[model samples]
Target: MVIEFDAELWLWEARRDDSWTFVSLPVEESEEIREMAGGQRHGFGSVRVRVTVGSSTWTTSIFPDSTRNCYVLPIKRAVRRAEDLEAGDVASMTVELVDI
Candidate 1:
């Protein structure tokens, strides 16, 4: 299934403590995805997906965040540079939920 939405690209603070960057998925969108992905997920409640931001598209997995009640998309430094994205930047993303 494919889910598309726009959200601000924000860094996960605790993750950054370990030097990782993440983009948050809106709560509503995450809910929809959960329904669609029903009973299918990987380690850490992660759902595999192909994500696109700006002109960059890559395959990755989004992990559910209990604190935020949503899913967080990991954005590597390479992706950030290719998309010219930074923390707090609004990004339009398309998520193709794979292995669902």
Candidate 2:
């Protein structure tokens, strides 16, 4: 199944020595995905997903964010350039839950 939404890209540093940028799935969207998954998840509560942003499409996983109580989509450096995405820039995204 395919899920679509819009969200702002943001930077996150899970570790002090490392940093990554991510796009968070809205609560409504995340809940929908969880319901569809039926409790299937990998480590860190990550749900495998195929993501599309702008002109790029790739496979990745969305990790749960307890603070926000939502899921976050990591945007790779290559994808950021291809999509011309920047932190704080709102982007229209499509996420397809994988291994369902």
lDDT of each: 0.83, 0.84
- Worst 10-residue stretch by lDDT in candidate 2? 10-19
Q: RMSD per prediction, one decimal?
A: 1.9, 2.0
Once fitted onto the true fold, the runs of candidate 2 whose alpha carbons sit more than 4 angstroms away are 13-19
Instruction: Give per-residue CA lDDT, model 2, range 1-100, as digits (tens).
Output: 7888888877886533214888888898788777877768888888999998888999989988988888898988888888777788998989998888
Off by over 4 Å in 1: 15-18
- Please write out the lDDT profile of model 1 over residues 1-100, one tens digit for every residue: 7777877766667665424777778888899888877888889889999988888888999999998999999887888888887877887888888787
Query: What residue pairs are clashing in model 2?
Result: none
RMSD of 2: 2.0
